[model samples]
Target: MIEAPLGDPIHHLLTPEALRHPAAAWEPFRHREGLWWSEVLDSWVATSLADCSAVLADADRFCSDWRKLGNDVPDSRLTVQILDSPEHTAVRAQLVRAFRALDWDGVRDRVAENVERRLAAVADRAAFDFMAEFAVPLALDTIVDVLGVHPPEDHRFPVVSAQIVDSMDYALRPETVGPGRAARAALAELTGQWLDGRTSGGLVGHLAAHHDSGRVTTAVLRNSLRVVLHSGYESASRLLGNALLACLDSPGSLDALSGGVDDTALQELVRYAGPVQAEARGCVADTEVNGHPVRRGQVVTVLLAAANRDDRVFDDPHSLRLDRTPNPHIGFGRGPHACLGAPLALLLTRTALGALAGLPRPLRLLDQPRFRRNATLRGLERLDLGWG
Candidate 1:
């Protein structure tokens, strides 16, 4: 058996500072061959592309439920993210079909309108935090509207979503857990109310009918809606912020996108600067990953960002290539647990970028940005930008 490496556990690896400079944070361990125990995380860290893919694909040997990862939460089997095998397969089929059937053009139109409105509001200001004043609101409103719920004109829904997303972080304080759980429960109740016998056209109504037909459990229906709401906005908002920053950093990329890049190019942008840095899975059975042993009930974190930048995969992993084809990055994850809202996220992203394409050259940063401190979610809290 290969022994786990010994050293100071990587602390604050997900801090804004660390995430902003991933190479500095991960360079030391990039040379490590396989899975090694991280004392800081009390979980094994998988850095290489091969190792991360192995952990994500072999679901029989690993679990995705949070309860398995030491969280004292309610039963999670009904949740789309945590469900395994047969159940996950069935539920995901329904969700996938429903999501694909969504009027993506309509969604894009709505999101584009929202984006224009957000920009109009900030057009008068000298500069504003792009994250708070723009990305967050646009994401929250667009997703909520598509899900058949009225987006509150204030910060209520955004606040709730942020709380739930933050709770997913590995390092949770005692104080944080209580609020997170409460927010989750509240969200469930809110989602159920929105879907209760509503005939209005939307994904939630279809799910409600599915629930009423006895095809799906109440828990499954409610939690699936919860998953969409949580996953849709949190990741999309951060991705918008990251992608915008990336475009500003590379004017040629902005020019290429402005001139109309295809879905493949949009995907390349996600691969290059997507917000998700890492993902966690719990090992269920003894298995060897990339020739390294991972025992039952052990947590393994796949460094997705690292894998995206792996030299063996992309021709120039660090360079932003708009036309990179066959780019099989795990930005949305892989296997059965791949992001369910990926299509919607991509649509929204395309619309957002298209809107940004109209901005004047030489976007300016009004102030230094601030990033959230959550270990799992990498996003900016504030990014002040302007173009005059």
Candidate 2:
């Protein structure tokens, strides 16, 4: 692993400005013809649409198990994200089944209910902080239902999730290491409450069955559940707020999605404001990215956000066209390690938007949106909106 000089503090592409306005922030990086080196991760960051797609598709050449490249794995517990193929496939197959087992229609209805409750709570207010009052709790409630946890009203979940958020931002803010670790431990302990293998419904039932059949151990199950809670909560909340922010900004975009959920329009929103920005893959064998040789043991970070707006792939790459067809944006990525929570995000957002459309009066942005300090999961910290 190459190291930065002691005197020169390393810098990264995900700066504070980038986190706030990513679409414009990533413009310069995308302008670069090909792979660029990240001094922080000591890896080549792929920017072009073709290059990012190629890396994600050919997982064998670009392995997800980045540990071989010598950077310490973020979480010692083995989660599906970094596992190599065959093993990843086996685990993923079971997870796909568990996900498929969900009654999406039912889940969508519950999300709608959560949205109504939130909206009703702020009915008398002149304005409400959308991110805090609506987005966060709605997503958390739906996730708790899916996980089959009780006292679904627990406030600690979001509090813990918020604290550890910086942990995932270690790539951008190294100071998050200690606090992030503490937050993760607290989240895991709280999530462990649901690991009793008692719930026989929703996603937890599937885990309980796996435990009963000796397919997975209790410790692994606890880690997996914790990952699901933390990851699922953050993804859904951010995607919810970001999508609405984009829709409201674009002329007639929200109305186009007013009455129903259009998958194509939703995909465009994902491309425009998807939280996941980059994925790091370790080069298993020597390979050529855009004809440039990348030695084995080196890492290639695929910039999904940049590729989503690559002009060669999407015309008017920066604009949101709800009607755009043949949308091949990798907002959820492609191939083996594509986002697992994409379906949940879509369901939550679709239900929320559809419900909001039924309101007696249309909502308007009360103030400029502010983003949380995050690199990968770019999201809003607060978004105030009012019916007046």
Residue-level error in angstroms, candidate 1, position 374: 1.9
List model 1 lDDT by residue over 79-169, tens digit each.
7887876667777877776666678778877887888888788777777788888888788877877787686454576777777767767
Overall local distance difference test of candidate 2: 0.76
lDDT of each: 0.75, 0.76
After superposition, the stretches of candidate 1 with alpha carbons farther than 4 Å from their true spots are 1-9, 66-73, 152-155, 172-175, 197-199, 212-215
Please state the error at residue 180 of candidate 2 in Å: 2.5
Total backbone clashes of candidate 2, pairs 3 or more residues apart or in separate chains: 0
User: Could you tell me how far off, in angstroms, the CA of residue 129 lies in candidate 1 after the best superposition?
Assistant: 2.1
lDDT of 1 at 156: 75
Compared with the true structure, what per-residue lDDT tens digits does model 2 show for residues 170-204? Answer: 76677887776777666666656666647778787
